[model samples]
Target: MALLHRAELRPSKLELLAGWLPGRQWFAGEAGAPVSRVAAYRFDDPAGEVGVETLLVRAGDGPVLQVPLTYRGAPLAGADEHLVGVIEHSVLGRRWAYDACGDPVYPPLLAAAVLADAGQAEEYFEVDGKREARPASMTLTGSRTGRPVPTGPVSAGPGDDGVTVVRVGDVELAVVRRPVPADVPAAGGLAGTWPGQDEPVLLAYAR
Candidate 1:
């Protein structure tokens, strides 16, 4: 389960993305366009530490873009290249946000989610000091193949065609930065559906 507080972020997520998105090679939107949040989903960290969230955003008239991020209380060692920005959460205090692709906790979880039948985590928000269920803005389901997946640290590979491949041991997990339908069936991967997109689209795969 993922707990969300009814708190404010000093420099909102969009504020951070505004400056960061333009630097991404996969971003096709016009520079300096206003960014809007479309939807998002989350995956829980079993140890209940880092926050893993994937946001779908749009800029101007550009297509929706996918960005996965990890939030931690402290900076991740040796992840300077992947740091998106620092955020001040009203309730959580200071947070270090990093690109999920470079977060060690993310790869193994991604690999397991794609290979197993794992689903998005349940979300709840604080309202009047009470926790209430907050349904996810987007829904994601993993392809269930019952196949074994790699565990432990996974090194992120260079992006190619809007996809980033990460490897752990001999296994590689491909994550799609731009959501699109796959030409063929997914052997083991993750797919998602949002408000405007009724059909599930391929978002990742184990290759």
Candidate 2:
């Protein structure tokens, strides 16, 4: 389960994304337009050390962008290239955020989710030392692959058709960087939905 805290974050998530998104090669938004977060989902780290989350956001009427982020108490060794910048959390103090694609802890968990046909992790909020169930703003569904989950560092590279390829071992997983029409199928991979959406949107597939 993923536990959320009702606390303030210095610079905030959106603030950080606003400054960082435009510099990304895949961002389709107007450089100066404001960005709005549509929805978000979380995945729990089995070890409970890393916080994983994916955010769906848009600038104007441009395509919805999928950004997976990982939060850690300290800098992840060898992940300087993926750093989104450090920020201070009101409840957790300082945090280091990185693009999930480059985080060593992310790919294996994501592959496991796909192979197990799992959804996003359940969420809870702490209040008065008690945890309360919190509904997720977004939902994810993975397709069973039956293959053993791949391990090792993931190397991300640009793929054909605008997808991002995350290589684990010798297997390459293609991640849809932008939201596509609902009629499109994700095949044997992953799909997601946000509130008010009638159909699951394709997110990624094994390649």
Candidate 3:
């Protein structure tokens, strides 16, 4: 039988978010509400330097806002145990665990994800929320170095009122443009199969 290297769930940053999301003014949940998880997915970087996680959370009475996060294992000065699990990656064969979005290698790792999918090239990065900051538009950026080569012209997808869609190669990521409520069921576990090498949706972002 094939070995199943599943993610060991514990009190993660999700615990912090459980209390924080309901307090935000931009939150779409009801006044004084609750939120929880619905499903999630994990992706391994082709280069084996980082890991990407997308969480599909169903906030109370609101639309599901997809939260994308990156993980790294290099010990950060202040991260310590807050970095979640430090298990050996089945694919990478190295033990790693840390909030990767803030890792110095995040930009290139993310850019690699984009380029590997035959999507856009080096655009830019962003920082927001309390956890791993997010990457905003592709046209804006101050960092200019090519770890992941850009392939072609960037394209847009059908975006909703608060969602932003960007086409990377053949994939479409729907990024959340606005914040929403935080009252909902907790994510029981991550869902969906591993993303193929080239799928139409690299990630569907939310806020």
Compute the lDDT for candidate 2: 0.81
Candidate with the greatest lDDT versus the true structure: 1
Give the clash count for each candidate: 0, 0, 24
Model 1, poorest ten-residue lDDT window?
180-189
What TM-score does prediction 3 earn? 0.40
lDDT string, candidate 2, 92-135, tens digits: 99999998988877777767666667668889999999999998
Please give each candidate's TM-score. 0.94, 0.92, 0.40
- What would the per-residue lDDT of candidate 3 be over residues 1-207, giving only the tens digit for each residue? 011233443434455345545643335655434556654444445565555654555466775555555556455565453354444554434444543333333333334433333232221222342233223222111122233443344444336665545544433434442323322112111112222212122232211
Which candidate comes out best when scored by TM-score?
Answer: 1
Residue clash pairs of candidate 2: none
Please, what are the lDDT tens digits per residue for candidate 1 over residues 83-186?
99999999999999999999888887887778885888899987888889997787777877877766665799676889888887667878888887664246
Q: State residue 27's C-alpha deviation in candidate 3, in Å.
A: 3.5
Candidate 2 Cα errors over 4 Å, as ranges: 182-187
- lDDT-best of 2 and 3: 2
- Candidate with more favorable, higher TM-score: 2 or 3: 2
Candidate 3 overall Cα lDDT vs. reference?
A: 0.40
